[model samples]
Target: MTDAPFQFFDVEVLRTERLTPAVARVVLGGASVSRMASAGRDQRVKLFLPHPGQREPVLPDTERADWYDAYRELDPAVRGVMRTYTVRELRGEAGELVIDFALHGDEAPAGAAGATAHDTGADVHGDAGTASGPATRWARAAGPGDRISVLAPVQEENGGYDFRPPEGTDWVLLTGDESALPAVAGILESLPPGLPTRVWIEVHDPADRQDLPTKADAEIVWLVHGTSPTTTEAIRAAELPAGTPYAWTAGEAATVKALRRHLVGERGFDRRAVKFSGYWRRGASEDSPMSAADAEEEA
Candidate 1:
């Protein structure tokens, strides 16, 4: 965690747009998120989507580690779908918070299927399992005026933010599948202008390719599934700059693990300089203890 403690707020949907066939862009608006100090890049926020036909989402009045316990006490039908995601863009002047949701993917398109547990990319569960989850299904049909609850980072320590770049590091390396797009995009925006970098993103659909804006000297590499190297392989193939290059990689659990191993164990990249995480695991749903969000919550 890179920021302060998190606080809960009630927010309404200001608008929704289709970024791609499988991705939905949602803007959550209100004084809570709009007036919030920027949580910074790659910060995490918990979204409590409303139950179908319900006007508001059910949320716990507690905080710290107790909130999870209290939230778990609610009826599943009323609790709705509780998932985590990265803050894509912060619009303080407009009093809005932009979040991209990768719509549900398992039985349909994968990337941008549901608001991913980490980023706005992919969902780990299939439609059969996600059919009842409010986040995915609600995102599929969510419209303006619909409301949800957001647990955003507070100004105190351990507030659920995740960005951490070491001081004096010269260059950067970033890799992830579609599931990490939102975080990666936000990170790119935060980097120092014109810093040399390498970015590798893996996605199944060409439409998932986005025109990510960055002031860094970023070389964008789109690794299309079935054609380009595996996300890990692509990372292994990329050339990092000289003198203490920091790397951050994420996405599917197994692949992220493999990339970490390749960077540290095999390639001799400094262990402390490489930041990686498993965004989601293959063949696992958000309910599984192995899912990324579950692990983070428990941590």
Candidate 2:
């Protein structure tokens, strides 16, 4: 499965740590992760989380091309929730994979553009896994030694990764809401120390702003919920740096579209040079039945 685009790997929770008030880091270990050569920045993996009660989720047959269709055929009640997540960090040497989850607990504020944020991204339980989202709720409660399934990209052709800034760009603009933070952090870590960048990250609370490691000449801007503007609005109003600027933006579907329009339509930025993704839509949960193609951006 070295070069296979799709592969299933069983991973066990080795440990967990709280990264911020509304975020937790879970480390998983497995042989497959150790041998993985290069996980592109912003790599997207599908997680098969255990449903409400059952542990040791029923495994799926991933060898066939119709794996997803077959998965859809399973009994809805027994079929676990499949959510997409960004790989926050992958330590190939230690066989550890880190994933940062944006906790949407009961007290967490509502999301942007009418997203599923609750009470300013704070959970009344003061812990993860109490949000309305099944993934968040589960992640908050997940612990060490627990088990789950992951369908990861194998660094093959046309992989599921998202980070791909065009070649020869003078500077970069990285902006997104919390959902995009994991990928944004991965991208920042992989960047060269010399590249200049303007980064805008919006979170519900200041505590949600985790340490972002980057050596690039980054003018980092942190946006707090009540005091700051929306991610799209702030980024749209920002002045782009001199020279050819490549922009990568993500977050709510509506917000992403608005930002893209401002960059290309209003600012006259080249469409092909801008990259964007809709991590989620307004009023939609992580498992919302949204068409993947719905996220349109500059080609």
Candidate 3:
């Protein structure tokens, strides 16, 4: 049987707000956005950004037999850059959805020209420079009437680090950088009430931490860089309580990998009980091709 065809939808920015100095929340809306209500939390979708002057992006006809070629033949300028981001929330009432942007420091690359343009002027650095690419620039500038392109959610077989607590596990361990915030938050919000869970998050500062409503008993430890000598390192140094605990970790590729080794290899935690992912790698550009060296090192 043929695989289900991928669906593409066009959307527009309805509003935006700064959640923190480094995080910006963008709400997208349009008739097509209502369909996203079925998307699962933590599911990632590709965002396509139009060129600086274009009002809207033209998506390839995935239905065509030569869709791949057609996609390749599209004008590079209008092709719109792509980025993998999670669906934070989907509201059917206004056909609105939200995604958060981790503003890279001024040294980072500038984003494309759309929803993100207005905020791009700030001198943020890090992956944001190149990571933002075109979609981020467009996202920053995106306003109530701005039009954008969105593809149907692509559910990966093992796309994200799962956080569902294992049966019999009494404790939970959660760790990641700012990029992992959305997924971490989604996991925390979905837990069953009265379950005991402990979360450790590493961020640039204490302010990056946000209160999450959950029925499960949770203890959150926020690790801040600069103030804390070892932000990510502290997570590794932390001693897990005596008991089988479900662990979830994601963040910079190298750091997450280190924690994975410590928990599973050194600490002897069951590999199946832990979920870990590398959201991004330090000093790497989104446009740069992935390399074997990077993979081997992270592994």
Q: Candidate 2 residues 1-299, lDDT tens each?
A: 44476678888889888887667789988877865534657777777778767775665587777778888888866886677778887788899888887777564545421232332222111111323466666777788877788887665434677667788888988887777888889889888888999999878777677778888888889997668887667876777688888889877666778888888998888988888887765434433344344544311
TM-score of 3: 0.79
TM-scores for all candidates: the values are 0.85, 0.87, 0.79
Q: How many residue pairs clash in each candidate?
A: 12, 19, 29
Candidate 1 vs candidate 3, TM-score winner: 1
Which stretches of candidate 2 lie above 4 Å from their native place? 1-3, 107-131, 156-158, 285-288, 297-299
| Cα lDDT of model 3 by residue, 1-299, tens digit | 02433356778877898786567788888876765533343555556667788787666875666764676677766675555566667676778878777655442333221111123321111133233445445555667777766655423343322455667987777876677777778777777786677777766756557776778888778877556645346756666577788888766666667788887877788988977665565444333443323432463
RMSD of each: 4.3, 4.3, 5.4
What is the lDDT, from 0 to 100, of the residue 218 in candidate 1?
Answer: 94
In TM-score terms, candidate 2 sits at 0.87
What is each predicted model's overall lDDT from 0 to 1? 0.70, 0.70, 0.61
Off by over 4 Å in 1: 1-4, 62-65, 106-133, 156-158, 291-299
lDDT of 1: 0.70
lDDT of 1 at 81: 68
Cα deviation of 271 in candidate 1 (Å)?
0.8
